[model samples]
Target: MGTINTTTNERFFVDYRITLNDGQDIKKIAQEICIEQTVEIPEDCVPQTHWDYGITGIVEDIIPSDKIKNQVLVSISYHCDISSYSVPQLLNTLFGNISLKNNIRIDNLRVPQSFSQLLPGPRWGIDGIREKLDVFNRPLTCTALKPVGLSSTELASMASQFATGGADIIKDDHGITNQPFAKFEDRVQRVQAAINEANAKSGTKTIYCPMLNDEPDLMKKQVDFCLKSGIEGALAAPMLIGCGAFVSLRRQTDLILMAHPAFAGTFFHSNLHGATPAFLLGRFFRLIGADISIFPNAGGRFSFTQEECNELSDALRMPDNNILPAFPAPAGGMRIERVSEMYEKYGKDTVFIIGGNLQQLSDDLSVATGLFLEAVRNCACATKEIL
Candidate 1:
């Protein structure tokens, strides 16, 4: 029952693709979302003045889907101020309540230019990270110090080996938080020490990025600890810590932020519901300041398809007025043997993360990582222009 003030143009729009099963009416569901997402009142009882001000969500139109059967795209418009220009509020306004609904997915969205600039997305995006590693014109290489349960000394030794082999980055696995087996401080310190020595010996610029988390205070403390030890980058699961907290860290520090997709699958797992993997992992994470966004590689260990990975890559690296391009890291059980294929897929503007395959190929981790480096640097599709 919401009426639009056609005179007012201060609004944003979202294209929601709704699947019409059981002969459901597209018009009713669109109106229902307008009511449910906004005023939370019965349509008949909605205040006249509120409608005059266009206070409730408004369905711009219902466009029949061209791609899928029984699917329709509803374009909804919301007053710009409703989101308060905050990343968290914008997301909540976009998908908070509707996320629980069946067969509704966010197909695409648009916000005003001013609104998009409220938060400076990605403190150190793809170019900044490439500068930090001093690797350019080729796919950058990264690996996680992983498998948990390892002592800090063991992980640090692993770090030294990877650094010696000239990998661009050696980061902590998302699971390697403040576990008692190798506490955050102890592990970060040891790993940095090992990488530092290796860099000194080999003249490589291998950055050590620890997984930072906990309360904001604790995360700041962790950053301080790492900064003092000459560490310049870190990783965190934005969904696990909340996107607002993640942005705060980006605005407050200079660390290159690597975003993990942990606990994010709940938001984009179903074909009939939730956000798309490209939207949540690539577009959303890039907007919230992920210098590098990591996802499970297609054909590696997860269910992501080639089309989905392409969408994700486009969302991250595509030029945008508001967001700088971020590195799309196709990771999670990735193998070194697929380096050439992955390079052809993701191209040079990517960060390839290969974990256990390095060890599986060689007893000497450095030799394994060296082979990884060689594989990536000499891929058939490559034309390196290191700067």
Candidate 2:
């Protein structure tokens, strides 16, 4: 069965693909989502104006899935005002209550491009980041100060080597924070100095972006400290710090923000349910201030399919909607040998994060980092000739 939606100027859309594994009825489930998503009261209890004014969710269609066997897709839309010009509330309207139910997943989500700014997308997008590094027509190289046990000085040494080796940006591993071995402030100061010293020697604009993960106020404080240390960018975990808090941080600073995919696995682990990577890591992450969105690459240690990675890249670099394109950094147990393959898949506007591979290559990280950069520069699939 299908429901037709008359053109109404005030509605945004959500496409939820669900499986009726337990003999679930199409009309019943569609109505349930419409009510559960907005105007939670009983059908009889809803006011007349809500119906007349298009304030309630209207199921646009219920069609069988073409790919996944026995699964179906339902398109439900809500009034634009229902979001209340808020991120959390828009999320609520999309899946707040239904998230608790089974047999559901968000296949696609869209708001009018005109209203995208209410969510505060990336501050320094793809072009802005390229401008910062002064590297163009090629994929950017990024690394992390990792393995947590390293003291601030040791991590700083790694940062200096990366900068000297022609790395475009160096960031903190998501695991590193205010640990006793390497406290946040101490690590930030030393790494900034190391990168600065390397830049001075090399005359390159390699940037140092520290990790900021704490309470909102504390994250703001860390930002202030980075600014004092002359740091140009920082990594953040939005899933850990709440989306609302992440948006607040974007409004508060102009620092280039890279989003780490920590704790996001819970949202998309099952084929039967949860959000897709394109929506969460690509579109939604861009909406909430991630200039560079990092995710597990397909052939890496994680299980992200190549299709998911392609969809995510499309979502980030798709048509303008009051938001800018974000660079997708494919990491997680990545190897440097696949540089050409990754470049072919993601193209020029991508960040290749090779951490463990760099360590595995050699004892001298400076040389290993240079080799990583050279691989990207020497990729045969890239469009531009070597400069």
Runs in model 2 with CA error above 4 Å?
1-9, 380-384
Sequence-dependent TM-score of model 2: 0.94
Against the true structure, what is each candidate's TM-score? 0.93, 0.94
Candidate 2 lDDT score at position 386: 52
- Candidate 1 residues lying further than 4 Å off, grouped into runs, are 1-9, 380-387
- Residues 334-359, candidate 2: write the lDDT tens digits: 88889989988998889999987798
Q: Candidate 2: lDDT of 285?
A: 89
RMSD of 2: 3.8
- Per-residue alpha-carbon lDDT of model 1 for 1-387, expressed as tens digits? 456545445888888889998878899999989888878889999989778787778999898888788989899998877776777887888888888789898877766676656556788888888777777778888998988999999999999999999889898988888889999999998999999999999999999889987887887788888878888888999988889888877887888889999998876677668878888898878878898999988887788988889999999999888578999999978988899899889888999999888889887889999999888888733454453
